[model samples]
Target: MSEYKATYLVVGGGIAGVTCVESLAILHPEESLIILTASSLIKNVSNVSFYAKTIVKFDVHDTEATSLHKIHPNLNIVYDSLKHLDTTNKVAVTESGIQINYNLVCICTGGIPRLISDSRKCKRILGIRDTESVQEFQEKLKNGRKMVIVGNGGIASEIVHATRGIQKIWVIRDDYISATFVDPGAAEFLQDTLKSNIEKNDSPVLRRHIFSEEDTLVSLNKNLKSAALGPDWYRKLENTRNETGEQELEIIYKVEVESVIEREDTEFPLDVKLSNGKTVQCDFVISATGVEPAVSFTWDIEPKFGKDGGLAVNELQQTSIKDVFAAGDVACASWEHAPHWFQLRLWTQARQMGSMAAKAMHSKITNEEVLQDFCFELFTHCTNLFGYRVVLLGKYNGQGLDQNYEILLRMTRGHEYIKFVLKDGRLQGAILIGETDLEEMCENLILDQIDLTLFGDDILNPDIDIDDYFD
Candidate 1:
């Protein structure tokens, strides 16, 4: 068995883990740092741009782990999966029998897709998470004519938009699409955009190299779970559109999958039965139904866990165990959250948490005081949906407000949609869809909690330049 020692150790190669290591490398360039990951590829955040105060936009690149060594000479990337964590002794054992002793450790193992119950019994059911799984899905999609997607999150929405020339059945338990991100009004505003077959250039600037044969072999032989796909992951997929330009789509709302039936005599390989007593035959089922925290390694003493099965961490990103911390989807915020801020398992939050965790760890080592990051003061996220730029700020959908908030809406049919949540005449949240370019103003309003009752409904009037008025 090989023995290694590091002043700082990080687990996982996703955005959170990589960000944490990068921050640590900058903070302690002379100290020995190690990153243990299952896959040889690591997610790197580049070309970062910040909008307003907290909304961040960045390009995610999957690069070879060896590349990081060149950038940070003090850092080492180990291709191994964590098997055990002895918190008492400050030791970690890998599946390859390599043991590492570390002064501080940060776990950012990320999450795995939460597939439907019948996924284990059926070969036609698939969950898209990592690069390997995405490749498998693309290959399978090439031969598939009809597919059923079960989920209402970003993954499902991306898949629905990226696929063409094939029949699609989108099954959701909510009445509206994208319930995870937007309210019903926003969803309705996007209905036409979703139905339009007009293709738009939605590809992001990808700064990654082509996979080599060695990379393929390593991916195939990997025993530990691969890291979750990062932002705009679907854009990398090869569209399996045939020569026919005709596209077919059907959406079944307010229903859940009751069971999956396989038949040898049917033309379609599987039949999906819904809770509404309807059955749909499809070539395969794609489960984009969210994810559960991936905590594969066992510890001498388990850390506190949240309801979502994630390691519960306080404002400083410290777990219950000493000298151990967690971030990303694997870490749930257990501290007193800001009134408008909440936890969501998104790439933006992952990066924020990762950087914050590194700061906390450094503070602990230096015996310095550290405060929670300001990014957690108000939730902010930006993404593209159906070729439209969507910006969500604070309590965008009036989450946790319990009907005490008033809504102000402005819609221009196909052009733009804006919605605001106000409580006690104070701006609480806002959602701007399309090229509204109001993210900066809205973010300021939410953070300032300015009273807008005087403005009344004229706040969203298109003729008035609210930015200047507010100024």
Candidate 2:
């Protein structure tokens, strides 16, 4: 075993891991650090792999930005996997038999798709984890064939819509779609959108939905456990449907594959056995089932929790073990107020946790100061779904409800939904879909900690203008 030591052993080179290491080096230039990753740096990213894709969010992204990183002498990407973590000994072992001793270890590996071993008849399926996969699917789609997408989250829906014109079926585990993220009212609107699309030849419906279990499914928060496909994926269903009783492919939901057998003499199609006790033939099976943090860690310590199990910590985002800290998608956090759920997920929370943890670790700041700076809304998560910018602030729908915050909501533009929770006139949390003006409000409520109770009943009205609050 090769033994090494560093002040910080930053495991996983994803966003949170990257941010944390960069902050550490800048803050404490004297500290030695090492970064671990399963693959080499995302330099030679191709159009077919999923790990590295050019995020097209930037207009005319200078693709040359990665070239500059290639020359960074200190930028070391350890091509190794975390085999074991001994939080008690403050040591971690990698797949390559490298044992590392550390004062602090951070895990920011991000996530992996909940996989299905069974292929059934779907052969050419892939998850839309990154740009390479999407571009690859795009190329294959040009040839035109039937494809079945499993699961009904944003990724599954996005891919379904992106490949709609080329024949597609949305395989949902439950009836309808989106059961986890959006509200019921929004879901109703989404259903109407799908219905309208099908009527106007904008999309096609193979059937209402397929179910793995019985008619009704229960969610912890009564939110849709699933229903409503984003416009991008379902709208394409219209193009693939035949109006004149032509042969049709299948789009199943709520059904699990009991078995998947490899097909002979073809690079495509997996023989899939369904949970419904039926066999279906599919050319491709894309699984968007869900994701778990890609934590390649197993620790033996008094730390009370592993990667899948969230960590228990105070506002400081410190783990059960002290001197040893955690943040991003690995640690758990709770507050004295309402909706106090330990979280180790989401990009916004990851960044905020990284910043807070960095401050807490520095000898300069006091714990009280760090705790005071810790606010739940600092964990603001936003995403672009089906051309709509949706932002979720704080913990809203979950098993744990903290009475410290209140829920405020309104109908934004058409299908867009907006909701915010306040505590003592100050904004604690919010969720806004579509054009609810999140860019402006998120900054105010989170950064300024403004008391908005003065907005009065106008808060219920979406017509209320937002420009006055900027100052």
Q: All predictions: root-mean-square deviation over Cα? A: 9.5, 8.6
Candidate 1, superposed: residue stretches over 4 Å from native? 196-228, 240-246
**Top of the candidates by lDDT:** 1
lDDT of each: 0.83, 0.52
lDDT of 2 by residue, 1-471 (tens): 677787776776544555566666566666666767665542121222111011111111112223323333343446688988887788889988988887777666656556566422344656554435555556666655666667766666556433444556666665655545554444444444333333332321111111121223212233222211111222323343334433233557678766666577664455567888876555666767655545456668656554355455456656677666666655555445323222435444555566566656654222334453434534444544555556655443322333333545555223566655556666555556675545455545545667777875465454555656554
| Winning candidate number (TM-score) | 1
| TM-score, candidate number 2 | 0.68
Q: Which pairs in model 1 have colliding backbones?
A: none
Give the worst 10-residue stretch by lDDT in candidate 1: 217-226
Candidate 1 clash total? 0
